[model samples]
Target: MAVKSLTPYPFAPKDTVDKFPAPLLYIGWEDHKLFCSPVCVPMPPTTTFGDLVRGTLPGIYSAHPDFARIDWAQTEWFLSGQPFTPDMDKTLAEHGIGHKSAIRFRTPGLTGLNGSCF
Candidate 1:
């Protein structure tokens, strides 16, 4: 959908990275219907992928019953809808994750609550 303006004027977008304290990172757990949409979190570009998974994600997705059972080694990761393996120790910036990048992960054996996908 495109918005048409009667008067055209150049203006900077408010959601640009410079407007936030940190870059916005969108994360989602695939096949988990509990969260209807992905979560947007402000994160430093320098934050390591390991910390994002271990320190950050737990705080957000731990409430899901299947969270604790996830096998990190087997988890499938996607960036901007493409499959990619991340180096745990590398920073998000190192992986080319810029502001508003979407990161999604799928737990191989865990679909959703009781396999209901919800």
Candidate 2:
């Protein structure tokens, strides 16, 4: 479905990078319905991808039973729907991840809670 506005909807987007103190990054765990949707978080562009995976992600996904079981070596990653291999030590800006970029990852042997896709 497409929306047909009767009048011009001219307004600045509230979520634009300039409005935030830091860039916003979206992340999701594939096959995990418990989250239902990706989570958006503000992070400095200087933050390393490793910190994102090892530090930030844990804080958000630790509630899931499979989170602790994931093997980082076997995980697959995607950025904006394209396969991505991140350099652990590189900053987000160095990897071209700007504000509003989305990153998704899948654990090879893990598929939701009890394999229920939840």
Candidate 3:
């Protein structure tokens, strides 16, 4: 076996990335929402996994007085005049698609098939 000499891609952003924890805290109020993505955010090698764990907590955890009583990750609250609920599980169940993985069968190879499965 032989090793080849190679260099890191030059065009890639050198700005260090930050890794975030899973089961992350997300916020949704009216038409606005914010959350971190495990699929999108990148972290530097220097950042310990523990730091990732702490970073996912609510941004207001450091300041607000009443936020401690609520699990911001699972609970929703409005900062403005919009109506909101703290129970994300129940709210999503009522508003979101329950069965995300429902199969839609299709056959592309069959002749005269319009992408439908019989």
Candidate 4:
């Protein structure tokens, strides 16, 4: 077998290709209304469930105190009716979760740190 020498592309990939959207996923979970507006989260395709949760939880809950109580570590992520494991190794791209992919987050119950737990 013979090997061919490889060289880098003359132009930066960014120069000729269109960039993916700034926000990579539409992440959301239901409230009393049964459906809530999904927050647009900026994430890379390589991000894992744990990474996404930890990375965005603070910002999301910071703005919406209503989400303050749910234990992020215990949270469950679902896409297209399938559960996402929290091993923190799965990448969104592996499951074809691409731009604007929808991810629903679920916790045991709705309770903020300040709120009483049932």
Candidate 5:
């Protein structure tokens, strides 16, 4: 199992480029057969893309080929594992992905992608 945390570095002020906030930490768990225990520090905000990538997701998640289509262009929500049959409903419900379905995706080849895999 892998423990994960998604925490935001303080969102910078719109006018100031260097104003970063301390990240709010969101934690999760990924295993050989399942992913569970999505917890966070300072309470994760509802579905923001940046939050998704930095704190709520595992870095090495890109290695898996099951979530390639899931885009974070509009947001920063990153993922860590591939969901199974029983997990489908819960996963969709939690992420508010109703019409969409999880499919095969590729993990990015960035060095240190899962470097933060907790």
Candidate 6:
């Protein structure tokens, strides 16, 4: 897993640009078999969970081909091995998610492409 933290940086004023490095998240996602390498994504704390997932998909797809075929609406995300609420409205800072956090993604009831539910 990538080295990351669970604490979000202090809130910044909107008029000022943050100079610190963006938070790095280690993502683990699987469709059929477990993914081969850990996926690290850097995002600002102001980003909402919904926005993060939508924005990150393109880059993730380039790294993990299986990610391309899944229905994102049915996807789930986890943090610290616990289920992260699929509430797309909350920002990372609003939930106090800081630097170096680890996130995991899974498609409900599907394994690779073998699940008949597809």
lDDT of all predictions, in order shown?
A: 0.94, 0.92, 0.28, 0.62, 0.35, 0.67
lDDT score for residue 26 of model 4: 76
Off by over 4 Å in 4: 1-23, 32-36, 111-118
Which one wins on TM-score? Answer: 1
Q: How far out, in Å, is residue 27 in model 2?
A: 0.3
After superposing candidate 3, which stretches have Cα over 4 Å from the reference?
A: 1-39, 56-118
lDDT of 1 by residue, 1-118 (tens): 1468889867767798988999999999999999999999999999999999999999999999999999999999999999999999999999999899999999998999899863
Give the Å shift of residue 54 in candidate 4. Answer: 0.8
Model 1: weakest 10-residue lDDT segment is 1-10
Q: What's the best-to-worst order under lDDT? A: 1, 2, 6, 4, 5, 3
| lDDT score at residue 28, model 2, on the 0-100 scale | 94
Q: For residues 30-90, could you state the per-residue lDDT of candidate 2 as single tens digits?
A: 9999999999999899999999988899999999999999999889999988998999999
* Better by lDDT, candidate 2 or 1: 1
Tens digit per residue, CA lDDT, model 6, 35-81: 56557766788889778777875666545445666677788777867
- Candidate 3 lDDT by residue in tens digits, 1-118: 1245586434543332222432222222121112121122333333343343345233423242332433335433332224343232232233321221111111123212232222
Comparing 5 and 6 by TM-score, which wins? 6
Which stretches of candidate 2 lie above 4 Å from their native place? 1-10
- Tens-digit lDDT string for candidate 5 (1-61): 2235587555534522133242233343322123333443332224453444444454534
- Whole-model lDDT, candidate 3? 0.28
RMSD of 3: 18.8
| Global Cα lDDT for candidate 4 | 0.62
